[model samples]
Target: MTELKQERAIRTRTRIIRAAAEEFDAHGFAGANVASIVERAGMTLGAMYFHFKSKEALAREVMNSQTEVIEPLLHSEGLQRLVDITLVWSYALRDDPLLRAGVRLAVEQGSFGLKDDSSFRRWERAMTECLEAAKKRGELLDEVEPALVAQFLVGACTGTQLDSQLSSGRSDLTERVVRMWRYLLPGIARRGAIAAIDLDPGRGRGA
Candidate 1:
């Protein structure tokens, strides 16, 4: 494709994804309508199909794109860095439609004929790496296993945000994640390291 055509195609695909994200966020994958997504994009069914083969494909795209919202914030490391990732991701879950829709679809996709776990695994791996770094730096307790801690942190963060979404539309998600870190820190980090860690809910935003 020529440059102009490629650019147009990119724009069209982005439009479709944004529209589909809105529909999925509101109705979830099982209830979302492909026609409604096309209409919301202000494009014809053919145009939507030209970009995405089906609703499943569109949903998968949204799920994959959720990481885009956090890839930039993942630049840091260590235990505190993991906290930053969770808090920033919580902020995205609250504010970014694409991410919120992607996470919802990722959780609900098994019913929609796609049972992908790549999104969750990516998050787990990132957390694991961060914890491993903290362990090497002597920041964690001697008995702490970085891998187990990573899984626990990922599960805790995911569960907290998911509950927050269902409870109050995620308005209190930051506080919940902060509380989670506070509750978890004593077991994972060395007593001396605890004093240096920042658990502020707004820490992610400042980064």
Candidate 2:
């Protein structure tokens, strides 16, 4: 394929994945039917497999892609970026089906235990870099371990999500999660880092 053709191919693949994401969200990973996903994408089973080998594989790719988008946004401009990351994640956790599905799938799988996923190594690396930058800048406690901090943050966020999924959204998981994180991270974050979280987008930091 030419460059233009290849780009189009990539876009088409993205569309298929996005469509599959909704299906996965509605049905969970194992329950989501491939033909339904292909049909929703207006593509054939062969075409679906052309981009992803199987539903399990596609779900993994979906989580992996979310990590890519979220990782950069997490490490932008020091503490401000961490706040931005949390805020972005809060809204996304509530509103974005792909993110919700990944959380749900991870929970429903039920065999991973409480240990951090070494399988999500790329995600761990990204968090390590961000946390190390904060530590170097004195935005985090001096003795803090970045890997442990990363795993703690992940658990706090994903655990909330898994709990929410089991009973629907009746318990206000998002609010409770943000509150818990505020307490957990501030203990380790600089004073400035704690205050850096008020980025309200167009309304200024706290207007």
Candidate 3:
């Protein structure tokens, strides 16, 4: 009986989170309505409050859920791995409501008085690790700094994705990300490495 209760509880929480993501994605944090979220989840207000105490808590969970969409990129390393991450994220942003909500909330976090920047920092750390590996493998230019480039890459991706979102609802995000990499690689990659790196937006689909 206890096990069954726990499973049902988990399911209820998951449903509420999914519904919250949908609402938050469609409406910014300030605009999202808890009543509507409960309606979308097919749950009562008391049921949702049992899992998340407040709207801010729900928003934080939605933001954190963005990491759930990323699969482990075990087959590649260095520069290729870095590119794969961005391309995969572009596709994820288009397909996953949770990720889209998280990203939107992240950009508008300031409006809600949320100070968390962990998501952006996490991306920077991942990119920095990949760039460091690339530098060790002689794939990067001598002057390229892994940490600095990682920060720049994250900013570039943020801008490109926002532009894509506003222009076409991210229908062309992958192509835009490819263009972003094309513009960035020449400045950071080694002379011989630029031609060797695959810039195909579809490359991440298999990764």
lDDT for each candidate structure: 0.83, 0.66, 0.87
Q: Backbone clashes per model, in order?
A: 0, 0, 0
What would the per-residue lDDT of candidate 3 be over residues 88-116, giving only the tens digit for each residue?
88988876788899899988899989999
| Model 2: per-residue Cα lDDT over 1-207, one tens digit each | 899999989988988878887888889776799999998889889988988898877777666555654554443655555545555665566657766666666656554333324335655566666777777777887778888777677766666656665687724654655676567766778677777655453211111
lDDT of 1 by residue, 1-207 (tens): 999999999999988999999999999988899999999999999988877898888988898787667778755568777878888888878667898898888877778778787777777887888888899989998998877877777677767878898899889999998888788889889888889887877776736
Candidate closest to the true structure, highest TM-score: 1
lDDT of 1: 0.83
TM-scores of the candidates are 0.84, 0.80, 0.83
State in Å the error of residue 127, model 1.
1.5
Q: Compare candidates 1 and 2 on TM-score and give the better one.
A: 1
Error of 1 at 43 (Å): 3.9
- lDDT: worst 10-residue window of model 2: 198-207
Better of 2 and 3 by TM-score: 3
Residue pair clashes in candidate 3: none
Q: Model 3 — TM-score against the truth?
A: 0.83
